[model samples]
Target: MSPTLEFSFRIAITVDAPTIVSSDPARGKRQLIPILGGEVSGALEGHVLPGGVDSQFIQPDGLCRLSARYALATKDGTVYIENNGIRRLPSAFTANLFGDDMGFFKHVPVEDIYFKATPTFEVDDPRLHWLTESVFICDAKRTPDTVNLDMYRVL
Candidate 1:
């Protein structure tokens, strides 16, 4: 008899700010935009891409939504599979991508940050496996500030 397959993986992403050049707000608060030219280290199981690079995402309205060109994995970090197609964030989400208090670019020193990720299929490549959507939040320039990993998974 054939055995069922289990897949999974874990990601450790280090996020930093100051990708784009911007001046402080004239009178209101300001938040730092994230730079995506960092390192992505992790292991994949079911369907995933071993090593891939992410691009800078800047929404037309000025909200940045970066896309990671990678795949999903199974539970055990053994089986890697490909996704059917791409995915995208709903218009509602993109409308206020950075405005969301739970998302990035919050000027407040939040004790907790939130993240959300979806999938897009516009860049379909057989070489890679599944595409994913992810989100995260971090404290704004606080001593105890940290980049939080809100979510990461195949969509």
Candidate 2:
């Protein structure tokens, strides 16, 4: 029997409060937290779009989706939040690693926040490979809890 290979990574996040020009209460709350011991989904060549862009597609693949639920707290204990979510990235950024938009963030923000995740395998498929080691900044307008952002791996 082949021994299972588990891929792991360490994630570091920095959250800052919104700038003076922008009026968001969550701005300037710079924080960095590290999440150790995470798992990944099967990796593939991703998918191509109408505009001729390739992405690590996870829509149809059952093995490439990750749902993480974890907790975070400030050293002072003044703030605490539950960090959890499922996310992925386009293959272009991971493939090239350089461009105007790396597809890492769906949106930018300013907020009082700390980010981390506890990764687990939701599906079982040997052919699938997971790749989620970057931090994302999704837009507050599109999601709930504008001040709190959820982070995840590429899977």
Candidate 3:
């Protein structure tokens, strides 16, 4: 049987500028993007805690592998999130997107890129244990200063 997806929630994450950690030709470019907090809506409502980080490795061809770690504070309790994903852009837009100039990100058509993620949740509250028991995926989008994620549960 084919699995179906149910919309879970959406997270609008505010971010700071990317800090380039290394630029080795063989290993690709490494960067760290700080999470400045944001909001969550839909089934799960909360505020993203500050100090989270999104670490990325961009290949020469413009494929980015990203891992983001953050926390959400809700009425039920605090949930920790680890989201990992890949973003593939057209070769022509690679340099501008990954380079010091990120103005291109604002202009690129979302249809031309592939951005997706899988997120795992950890919560201490028994009431929120459902999050840890289910498998979740996310459709992600990137803006000049924010990353928006529409999460779905796999069933």
On lDDT, the leading prediction is 3
lDDT of 2 at 91: 38
Q: What is the lDDT of residue 142 in candidate 1?
A: 18
Residue 115 of model 3 has an lDDT of 91
Clash number for each model: 28, 18, 0
Give lDDT tens digits, candidate 2, residues 5-70.
333322222222212222222221111222222121122221111111111112322112222223
Please write out the lDDT profile of model 1 over residues 7-92, one tens digit for every residue.
22333333343333332323222233332322223433233334533343444443344444543333433322121211133444
Q: After superposition, how far is residue 131 of candidate 3 from its true place, in Å?
A: 0.6
Better of 2 and 3 by lDDT: 3
What lDDT, from 0 to 1, does candidate 1 have? 0.32
TM-score of 1: 0.29
C-alpha lDDT of all candidate models, in order: 0.32, 0.25, 0.89
Q: Give the best candidate by TM-score.
A: 3
Cα lDDT tens digits, model 3, 58-133, are: 9987789999999999878998999999999878787775476565788888778789999999998998899988
Query: Residue 26: error of model 3 in Å?
Result: 5.8
- Candidate 2 stretches with Cα past 4 Å from truth are 1-34, 37-64, 78-81, 91-155
